[model samples]
Target: MTALRRLVATALLITAMAMGGTAVAWAHAVRVSADPAPDATLATAPTRITATFNERLQGDFAAMTVVGPDGNLWSDGTPQVQGATVSVGVRPLGPAGSYTVNYRVTSADGHVVSGSWAFTMTVAGSGSPGPSATASTPSADRALPVWPFIVGAVAVIALGVIWSRLRRT
Candidate 1:
């Protein structure tokens, strides 16, 4: 009975350690807030679009774009990263329709996080649209989670330990 209890305790500890490691490894930056907000309707066009993440962002390859209703890029200049926030200037929006803000940023853990949100412009603007979206748009491919593989390895180890102990009995 004591041996069985010890085996169980060891297995639990190992499982906990594996889960903890994976939790840290999987800590990707998540968008906590955005300027203009998602699905927001505004009377005036914003000068810039900003995205705030839950974790600090990396400086490299941080790209943001505001695509206007006409399928042209409204985002002007390069994207700036300040801590957990990433933003880009808008080149005066055109047309009174939906504008999508697409962002592809690198998280603190060197993981790539990308997403897009749209806001409606109730009023039209005088500023001309930027270049076409086809000319320049960063790819926002999401990385796959590795927690499942970690969990599987933990289960296998626990099962092997239990089986070995039982065979010894």
Candidate 2:
């Protein structure tokens, strides 16, 4: 019984590890394009923040925010969704410096997604109107949770141990 359990436990662990790795790999949304592009200096600030993803997006854009260097919200309204393209209009930009465009959107497949970008404006126009910084802000955004792998791991490990113990006899 002991020997059988050990073999089963090992197999289970191997399977769990493989599945976890794959889950992390598959949960990302491939960004087709961004208006300013990451870390690009635009000839001029864009009037809108646009993101094109591999999948079509839904109307429920719960996490999009266009924050300027000064800590104010720049996105004029909710993001307008058209097919796979997502875009939000911006207020006029003030200074020529770095502006961070942070966004989170839901994919057609129901995945929660988030991302960000930075653009520099070299000249500040009078009343140009752009987003303001948050009371505080991070230079970039982070990824979301992976619940599938988390739940699958516990079950796989438990089953593997039980199977090994049963086979040992």
Candidate 3:
């Protein structure tokens, strides 16, 4: 209930809120759309696979690969980054099963975003499969979770409240 203690508690609460807001603001480019589309079933295979993100992406460190059901890489040459779209040439598709598209791209914020999605091919193509995907390409399972930071901020605010109450008694 003291003036100094109240000021300190207010400062902590404000700091925690500011940090949480910042964490939410810190974001990477997210895929807003795709060529074949996620989980889409296609009767005909497309020559190129493209993913459009929500924001602009960095031209450097952008890579994408399309893997056929045969477990071989079908992507040809290098992946291209144009504004928010990232695409790569597919060497025709093989097998009628599901095909996976993996991508690792740098966001305008300079953080790397990576993920994968699959689409089913109803009919197989005549083109041969490319070589297996190499480990050299950067791929990430997911982006870093922000829950921990939020939890920590909540804990700090809770502790501040508890300390203020303890000081009153």
Candidate 4:
């Protein structure tokens, strides 16, 4: 009985360690906050858009764009990353309509994180529309290999079968 209990405890410990490692390996950077915020209604137009992430970002890999309601690009200049925050300048907004902000940034861990949000302007501006631009979609992260987990589970089952046979004998 003591031997059986020890075997079970050891199996549980190994399973826990494997699961913890897998969780860490799958972790990705997340968006913490944004300047105009998601679905916010602003009284006036914002000259810039800023997004904050939970992890440090690669400056060269960071990109953001502001799309006006008329299907025009309003984001001006390249995005700048300072630590975990990324900001991009925007041309004066035109008309009172929803503006979409799209962003993609490479996390410090090399994972790409991308998302889009929109804010509505209550008052219109005198700014003219610019060229059309496409927003980048979030690239899917690489999935962890499944063979190891399957093998580990099979081994655990085999161990249990062996233990059961020993007990019967």
Best by lDDT: 1
Off by over 4 Å in 1: 1-17, 140-169
* Decreasing TM-score order of the candidates: 1, 3, 4, 2
List the candidate numbers ranked by lDDT, top first. Answer: 1, 3, 4, 2
- Model 1, span 129-157: residue lDDT tens: 87899767777333467899999999999
Give the whole-model CA lDDT for all candidates, comma-separated.
0.91, 0.72, 0.87, 0.84
lDDT per residue, candidate 3, 1-169, as tens digits? 6999999999999999998878635887889999988999999988899999999999987889988787888888899999999999989788899999988998888888888899999998888887876643445534568899999999999999999999999
Report the Cα lDDT for residue 41, model 4. Answer: 94
User: What's the number of clashes in each of the models?
Assistant: 0, 17, 0, 0
Q: Model 1 scores what on Cα lDDT?
A: 0.91
Assess every candidate by TM-score: 0.73, 0.61, 0.69, 0.67
On TM-score, the stronger of 3 and 4 is 3
lDDT, candidate 4, at 141: 40
User: For model 3, which pairs clash?
Assistant: none
Candidate 3: C-alpha RMSD to true structure equals 6.3
Candidate 2 per-residue lDDT over residues 24-106, each given as its tens digit: 55755657898878788865667788888887777774455677666676667677878777788877776667878877777
User: Model 1 TM-score?
Assistant: 0.73
Distance (Å) between predicted and true CA of 158, model 1?
Answer: 26
Candidate 1 local lDDT, residue 22: 92
Residue 26 deviation, candidate 4, in Å? 2.7
Query: What TM-score, to 2 decimals, does candidate 4 have?
Result: 0.67
